[model samples]
Target: MPISEEHIGRTYPATAPYEVGRAKISEFAAALGDADNPAYSGTDPVAPPTFAVVLASAAWGAMFDDPELGLSLSRTVHVDQRFAWTRPLRAGDEVTATLTIEKVRARGTTAIIGIAVALSTTDGEALCTASSTLMHTSEEDAA
Candidate 1:
């Protein structure tokens, strides 16, 4: 079944607190081709802007596995992504992400799902808001 507008506004549970480590930040930065940047090489480094996606991506599993949405993992394609930050993530910050379904639109056998993820400090300070759109094509040949 295709997702509908009614699925919008559905919020999922918060993910477990994930501690940001300096090493991981360095690794991510280097992977993004910033290996020589001083900002990401120190013990108290600030994460690259896109690092929030690391947390958001993990929390997204819940939405895909939800039976009500009936998503076909194999058929989904990430169409777009955007991020809004109150502050850059720093190493040693403990954060959690909560995902919400902002919108669901369908055309023929294809569905576009808009997901909003809120990343916050464990004590409730806002960190970042990440929004993503995924397009899922209906499976017509799978057994």
Candidate 2:
């Protein structure tokens, strides 16, 4: 099934606020081969640049779950991801993310979907914006 064009500009609901923790930040740094930098992995209050993924992972589901879009996760391939931070997020701060479908384009048996998720505080302060570009190739196209 093809993804519906109508859902292109739809904005999904905000996810529950998440509190950043030092442990999680450390874990991410370790996974990325970073050996705990002071600004990102210390007890202080700074997070790595890519810390936005914590909220993005929670927000991307809204796009894949769009019932009318008929997007098949199994057939999707993450093409690229970009993030623009208005400010860095600190541990222990609660933040929410709202997902928006930015664009959709089809190519042969494949499709490209762009989604932008905004991470912000509960009081409506903008934190950062993450954009994901996904390529969906039908099984037939793979074969």
Candidate 3:
């Protein structure tokens, strides 16, 4: 079965607040081999730009868990990712993310999904928009 085109433009509810912490920021920067950057360490550190993906992934959980969406994580390939930031994430900032289905295109047995996650402060200040493209193959098609 194919993913319904009706899913396009569907926006999932905002995820629970995720508190940004200095340790987590340092960890993420270290994973990227940027641990030595001054901005990513010390008493007050700003998260690396791509760190929004952490919050965005939380928002994506809603769509992935929606039975009606019929998505299979095992068969999905993340093809692309882009982020636009209003401000860099900082430690101690509590944030939430809301995922929106931007576009859904079917190609043979595969579907290309375009998704955007809006990351914001718990107080509702927009922080960043993380967009990604996922290629998902239908179960029957994969078999």
The sequence of per-residue lDDT tens digits that candidate 3 reaches over residues 5-89 is 8899889899999999999999999999999999999888999998999899888889988888889889999999999989999
TM-scores of all candidate predictions against the true structure: 0.94, 0.89, 0.96
TM-score sort, best first: 3, 1, 2
Q: Tell me which of candidates 1 and 2 scores higher on TM-score.
A: 1
Q: On residues 48-90, what C-alpha lDDT tens digit does candidate 1 reach at each position?
A: 9999999999889889888888887788899999999999999
RMSD of 1: 1.5
Best by TM-score: 3
* Distance from true location, Cα of 124 in model 2, Å: 1.1
Cα RMSD for candidates in order: 1.5, 1.9, 1.1
lDDT of 2 by residue, 1-143 (tens): 56745568889899998988988877877788885467775567677878898788799787778767767678888899999999898888789999988888877787888989999988899999999998888667767
Assess each prediction's global lDDT (C-alpha) against the native.
0.89, 0.83, 0.92
Q: Which candidate number has the best lDDT?
A: 3
